[model samples]
Target: MKKIDLSKQEIEVVQEVLDHWQEQGLLEQSKVRELRENIDERGFEWKALARYAFWVALASLIFSVVSLFSDDTLVKFVERFYETPNLVFCIFFGALAAMFYVLGFRNKKKFPEKTFSNETLMLAGSFATAACIGFLGQVVDRNTNHFTILFLLSIIIYGVLSVKLQSKLIWVFTLVALGVWFATETAYHSDWGFRFWGMNYPLRFTIFGILLTVFALWGQPRISVLQPFQSTSYVVGLLYTMLALWCLSIFGNYSDFAAWTGVRQYEIFYWGLLGVILSLSLALYGMKVKDSVSRDIGFVFFLLNLYTRFVEYLWDNMNRTVFFLILAVSFWFVGRWSEKIWKKKSAY
Candidate 1:
């Protein structure tokens, strides 16, 4: 039988739905196989390969550009041209960024199925955008040594471009720029201190993440146009908050690594306690609200918090072979449980 043509995402959703139905005893194994045979998937393996290939190509392009700058002949030739004006390099990359953005937009409209190729164009734009920002930084002179100004410019440019093009890739850079701006701005004001108001980088970022999450929640209803990014904003927020919590677990507001290591791990148990409390609280809130995204984030981080504590407290104290044996057993159970819950019975 000819399969029903569907995008990879659509196919995955369909498979999940089918699996759920099967698990509920609403679908037979034979019928599931029939449905699966009907759906024309390019297969996840191919999609994964394509995605990785795109990344490899992007990395190669970046390496090539960096190698050019490192080459003596190329560096001398560039230095000789137009007296090595920073303004020229800035304009050049800025123009290239604009061109790639235009190409990405056109291809997205014309060949929507060519996802990897379209994103490659956007990736090029991002590199050029960064280059433009770097050169602009070299050209600009300010009395202050703060580089937060560059991030501010990136936020403005990338934010505007994201909105104009409705490109998630550009929006990702915008979020990153916002993070950089916060970190840099706070560090600048703090006189490069590790602790500002008794909090370190991770703690500060945790607050930022919480604030961003709240903003996403509160702003989505009021701003209809921004609804598309509601999930993106929330995910980024969760990532920042959860990762910060993990960091705080290991080293509370201890400014220096040496200082942190000098103290016993048990002394920093309070931070780990806080992490466990926060993760579980979020997970419970997610369950109560029936929000899958929040629930998944909460649950994953809850497990992560527990493991982080285990690693911090028990890793060095126990014998290496024993530690890995326990770890292996734990993961085996987790895998078995997951397979039982999510995997369907074979059709054959």
Candidate 2:
């Protein structure tokens, strides 16, 4: 019953949604009547869009496959296309969108009693479309120039769709997409990437905050393990910290510590140890206070200890006994604290 103007790239999405809706026959009787009455409003545009998506799919596959036949195709393909992976990604998405429409029609008929078969189809189609395009670009050309951008688009798209649809599966995909993007981006760049700390840190922090907010809003009364954002929080948090610490460990000098303290090595070690202790203590406090985010942050500190120890002592293995001993003591303390919290709560 609603029609909206969208970008050229969004044609596939619109077509998929409409097609899925038509297939599911999910529109209410009154809504269906209204749609028919206003058939003149969007019918032609819709048909043309579906047709265009069809042609896009047909043409893209035909060309992509045909290109495989000619020796010149891969190398000689216009530099313009190479420059526009986004556009190519979009077209590839459009094509998969077309395929999804056909598949949705079949699935719709198969599950006639289902209320949201169409919405699922639409989202699944969109994700598949984006992934397929990305895969093609990544594999065939071996040029992953805009890969981060593409992955971000997919993740953002899934996040939005999940919210709109209230579909946990969509949320799951969104989280997975973000996790993969973070890992990929981080694994590739460490010290070299830290130079852009001023710009990248704020941007990433903002994104993380926003994602956490969205996740909180979406969760409403409580956070869900089912939530796409949940599993990734630990991973992404630890990853960012690992990267940041890598920066610190590489550049942190004893002279820098000497300014603040009497003995350089001992001071640095004390400060690091203090930070780890406080971070862990805060995590325990958070867990006691029922603050999930703080607890998560605390766990990240534990992860930091693991990472710092591994990196600093990989060849030397000097902290072997100390590391394991500290680990045991920390766990014991945490366990005692947890028992206290539970006992107090149980008494209440």
Candidate 3:
């Protein structure tokens, strides 16, 4: 259970949090098995620091992303004006980077780290910040000096935030940043421009998928929802869908010489195959988890099927009511089935 300094609401929620922790014992077990550390044993000891760190990680990520995409005239003007080395900016950035390094560096622990609660939203914020900074570096089109300065500065500031929040998500995020760095450093020598906007790198996509999968797997020790894990599920689902799209797009026939725009016949076949396979897989998984995980996954596949049928509707533009009715009926059946499974599990 988390203790909130500000309000009774946080204190009142303690019971719910305890139930949540008990329910999520699976994750606790997994972590213990992996790290040989008793994270679950720590209980509410790290709540405040972890929570704060999580927020900073999230904020840092968001700030970095926004900074990268910022079209702000003032920002641009500042960049133009202070184009050279400035001790003031350097000092400003240096401190934050130092903090980020200290917090996120796994081995740099003041004392051997023991327990930690994962905070998905906050860690996402951290990753987003790194991404934004990376993007900004890309935009500036520099060799190393400016980006390194920014990167270092951000690492310290956000790093401290990560510690304060005790966000495991930030730790995950740091891993991702490391991976991305590895990718860029190895293939293109820290050339992010090519990777972000360059040709499709299948391996990179695969890596991204793996990362999302890790998030999803780690998030759900049990079926209950939380801010971080739910986000992971959504991301995993989205990435899986994107993977299907990317593969199909690859197989589709395109114009050899002349310009034309339309999906190929092979594309339809691939999508249909994926839809069927995913639906079947989800239904199979439904036999295990009595929660909406399988149901939601299956829904994505069903939605794809509906889309294909709707495309056929476009050609005929008739019997649209039948299509809608089929969707409604399918939704109802799935809803009932899900309720039955959940109720049965609860009764047990």
Winning model by lDDT: 1
Runs in model 1 with CA error above 4 Å?
A: 5-49, 66-83, 283-292, 343-348
lDDT per residue for candidate 1 within 96-202, as digits (tens), equals 99999999999999999889989889878987998999888888944557788998999999888887877778778888889989988888888988877778998
- RMSD per prediction, one decimal? 4.3, 18.3, 11.9
Work out how many backbone clashes candidate 2 has. 0
lDDT head-to-head 2 vs 3, winner: 2
Residues 1-348, candidate 3, lDDT per residue (tens digit)? Answer: 442242344443443444455576734645434432212333354567876876677678668767865768757766775565444444444454445444544433443343332234344345446545655565565655433455454556454554455554553454344444444543444354433333234435544655655666665555442343455444554455445444433433232213213544444465456556666566567556754666566656555655554554453555778767876787798779879976776443
Q: Is candidate 1 or candidate 2 better by lDDT?
A: 1
My TM-score estimates for the predictions, one after another, are: 0.82, 0.39, 0.46
Q: Which of 1 and 3 is ahead in TM-score?
A: 1
Q: Rate the local accuracy (lDDT) of all candidates.
A: 0.85, 0.56, 0.50
Better of 1 and 2 by TM-score: 1
Candidate 2: misplaced stretches above 4 Å?
Answer: 1-130, 136-144, 175-194, 197-289, 296-334
- The TM-score measured for candidate 1 stands at 0.82
